[model samples]
Target: MILFKAALATGVLTVGLSASQAAYAAPLSASIQSAATDPRANVKIDSKIQVERTEESASGEITTTLLDPATIKVIPGDKLLFTNAYRNTGGSAVTGFVVNNPVHPAVALTEVLEDWALVSVDGGKSFGKLSDLSVSETASESAPTSRPAQASDVTHIRWVLASPIAPGASGELQFRGIVR
Candidate 1:
């Protein structure tokens, strides 16, 4: 079982099955792995972040470098690319696998690799595009107005796999975000 916890504007949002539910859940078990800004390894999982950088040579030639994300310090307006790798360590195949990542309140969602994934702007209540989403704008006490969502308004992202993950198989999910 996998659980996700994130801080939002209103409060914290928690998802996934609890320990008690996992005990009584289905027979097939799978693990979800992630890395924040660095790499981690253990008996059950191994995860890492691949940072992309462009540098100019003495000859004015442009080159790209992939480094460890831990070496970088993030600031406002900086963009980050993250890849979450999932390994199926279970004996049986796992189906209907899904991963949900919440965008930190200090940052915003910019791009995602999986086009089929859904985005939520209302603290994960509903998922859709920014133009299709709206929030209650209550600048005054008279009445509340709805306005189109900006990139900063995005709160959560979710991805659902269309195929089952076989035993010993691995997969990846990638996304990009910009600091506010």
Candidate 2:
């Protein structure tokens, strides 16, 4: 019996252990009733939602301030600083994320802090997938706008968390772009 147990622990019989464990650990099954009063099973409340609003003045006058910074007005070839922030408010960690903030038609994306964090030029469509921006060099030519950014333009920068963003934890990404 001792030899059989040892062989079972080390040999192909190991599969039985997993199967037995799974069988023993199987979730307690419950009847799933489709009551007329029951909401859709697939429906779920978004545990996380993004909230954004322009800052307002003391007397309620709307300000042009952008993300606590001055209004962005850049000359051609001038670099503009973009500070992107994100907060995790969900019960679970957000993983494998992608951010897409397209450049305005009048501007281009450039010079991201290389040593600070990862960056992707595909409009945050992918992160850290492309070559890291070199600090000593000028911004990327892809930063220039091929056309004018429209109402649906994505101007915000996206950040991906390499680690778990604990509940209430926030992250920021800063990069530079040029006005075209």
lDDT of 2 by residue, 1-180 (tens): 000000001121112224333222112121222323321211121211111234578899975432211222223544445444556555555444333333444445555453434443444444442333212222576553344332123333434435655556666555555545
Residue 131 of candidate 1: its Cα lDDT? 66
Task: Superpose all Cα atoms of candidate 2 onto the true structure and report the RMSD in Å to 1 decimal.
Answer: 22.3
Tell me each candidate's TM-score: 0.66, 0.38
Q: State the TM-score for model 2.
A: 0.38
Clash count list over all predictions: 0, 5
After best superposition, candidate 2 residue 40: deviation in angstroms? 21
Q: Give RMSD to native, each candidate.
A: 10.9, 22.3
Give the top-scoring candidate (TM-score): 1
Q: List model 1 lDDT by residue over 35-87, tens digit each.
A: 33212111132333344567899999999876553444434555556566777
Which ranges of candidate 2 are over 4 A from the true structure?
1-73, 114-159
User: How high is the CA lDDT of each candidate model?
Assistant: 0.57, 0.35
Prediction 1 TM-score vs. true: 0.66
